[model samples]
Target: MLEEIESSAHSSGVISMDNATRYLRPTGIDPIMGKVLNWLPKLGISIAGSRLLAVRGRKSGQWRTTMVNVLTAADGTRYLVAPRGHTQWVRNLRAAGEGELRLGRRTEHFTATELADADRVPLLRLYLEKWGWEVGRFFDGITKDATDAELAAVAPGFPVFRLA
Candidate 1:
């Protein structure tokens, strides 16, 4: 079943879940853009709530950093959504349960709780509404306006973490 999904994703440019790893392989331009994103935040420039997420590597124990969008809900909950699925950062956050969000010299230390698929719909919707223009491709055509059932169907492939 997972293999079928991955095969479809590979052929259709969607999120892939293969062998319990839900990751859409990055495109050639992704690394280039990542470098730019990583650099911009250090200059105190943020593109739509962009933050440099630094978390300890699950195995290596070294800090691994990546650019992530921080979505704050109306009720003041903050979330981190892995639009490209269960990438290294997601796995690391799962293992370490805490990390830091940085912009320039300001750093916010946070503990994360991974949300269940059933609990991710609203957060995912808000995330897509805010970041879909930048990350819509990875979502298999699902958008913020997508039906709840539609979002729920793909929620398992995209991990959402609540940051405290």
Candidate 2:
């Protein structure tokens, strides 16, 4: 199943690896590759917390599980960000506008809201601060203090979800 999705992305000509050099992620923080690399803990520690977000396919209505880095704010808002614009998980969230997240065996429903220009900046900043050093060119020209307009132009497809 995973291979198929990876294959499809390549076949569609939407996959780009040029940005990798500009961004840095500790070894496997790139979701563009696969979840196993980004999630599985090492030495009894996981650098980025992991979560399984389950959402129904927009076209098929079938539920799917995607491993993602979980980000939480001091204000109690939780978001799942896709630095890579061309990810299946991001697509699913957009198509459904709603999904459930699983941490271990616990599940919580969430409303998937596409973060506008105003929201992308902060989210991108958070992502960069956390994994940017590991990712390099992937985030070239992206700064922790980018304005909403800048984010909207650079990360047109990135989305931020609000937990319900």
Candidate whose TM-score is highest? 1
Q: What tens digits encode model 1's per-residue C-alpha lDDT throughout 109-145?
A: 9999999899999988999999999999888789999
After superposing all C-alphas onto the true structure, candidate 1 shows an RMSD in angstroms of 2.8
Judge candidate 1 at residue 126 and give its lDDT.
95
Give stretches of model 1 more than 4 Å off: 1-15, 18-20
The local distance difference test score of model 1 is 0.88
lDDT of 2 by residue, 69-144 (tens): 7777768777777755546666778788889866654667888676665566777778777767654345556766
Q: In model 2, which runs have C-alpha deviations exceeding 4 angstroms?
A: 1-47, 134-137, 145-152
Query: What residue pairs are clashing in model 1?
Result: none
